[model samples]
Target: MILWFTVVQVVVAVVAGVLGIVLGLAGRRPSDLSVGGLALLELLLIAQIVIAIIAPLAGNPPTGSLLEYWVYLVSAALIPPAAVVWALLERSRWSTVIMGVGALAVAVMVWRMQVIWTVQVA
Candidate 1:
């Protein structure tokens, strides 16, 4: 995991999460802002996926369990779409909150991925 990229992902995830939460608490239902924010996060995760693939070939392989890192990466990549689907189907403020929670969950997962890639031992 690239440190800078991880930082950017974390920042984006936090922003998306907070934005959705605030909008939901303000009684807003699913909107472009919330959905778009999640979409953006998803895009970033896709990029992270590519990076993860290339980084290892570039001789920057993770220090920890490669399988564990890959699992976390893959799981983190799935959260946004799931949350967006939930929000779209429900079309309620609470659904937006669920999106926020999902984004936050992705943030935590991404952080864990980083730790797995660089901090933990196999």
Candidate 2:
């Protein structure tokens, strides 16, 4: 995985998470800005997925289990959309909170992916 790209992804996720939490605390539902942020995060994740697949073909395979890495990548890809859908359905401040939680989840998953990529074999 590319280090800078991963860093950007983490930053975006954290920002989105914080934004969501602030909005929720302000007793607002998911706004266009929040939804757009989530959409942007989703785009970044999709880019990461493409890069992950291409990197190995380009001879840059991850050091950890490929299956595990792929699983994380796939799950990370799903989060934003799922959160958005849930938020829309719920139509409350809690929807923003849910989005925040989802954003945090993506951050952690990305961090785990970084660890997986950098793991050293004995």
Candidate 3:
């Protein structure tokens, strides 16, 4: 729901997506750097989840509709493991596709968070 968090996710996702394409073009499988980047993105998502939970606990937080945030958070959480699994199962260009999928997941999560935070009406 945070503006800056959405920005971060978008920037990271775009960078990751570009990297995915580049890796694929290079004809290499998912490299250590790609996995490391995914891990970093996953950590950021994990922190965001904790922050989303704690901020409301510390003070008042948006609560009219929690499902949107939950869905995005869950989707973001699943992406890393799913990507790792998919990348291993499908190598070369397909592995890059899996990486791109993870990046897209981040973008989707960012968009969902933005909408959830910006909506005024219940």
* Best first by TM-score, ranked: 1, 2, 3
Off by over 4 Å in 1: none
Q: Which 10 residues in a row give candidate 3 its minimum summed lDDT?
A: 60-69
Instruction: Give candidate 3 regions above 4 Å deviation.
Output: none
* Model 3 agreement with the true structure over 1-122: per-residue lDDT tens digits: 57887788778877786787688777869877777677777887888888778877887476446776778788888887788678877767768767866887787776777677566445
Error of 1 at 32 (Å): 0.6
lDDT of 1 by residue, 1-122 (tens): 89999999999999999999999999999999999999999999999999999999998889899888888888889889999999999999999999999999999999999998889777
List, residue by residue over 1-122, the lDDT tens digit for candidate 2. 99899899999999999999899989999999888889999999999988987998998878888888889989999999999999999989999988988998999999889888777441
Residue 1 lDDT, candidate 2, scale 0-100: 90
Least accurate 10 contiguous residues by lDDT in model 1: 113-122
lDDT preference between candidates 1 and 3, better one = 1
Model 2: colliding residue pairs: none
Task: Give the C-alpha lDDT of model 1.
Answer: 0.92
Residue 113, model 3, lDDT = 74
Count clashes in each candidate, considering only residues at least 3 apart in sequence or on different chains: 0, 0, 0
Candidate closest to the true structure, highest lDDT = 1
lDDT for model 3, please: 0.75
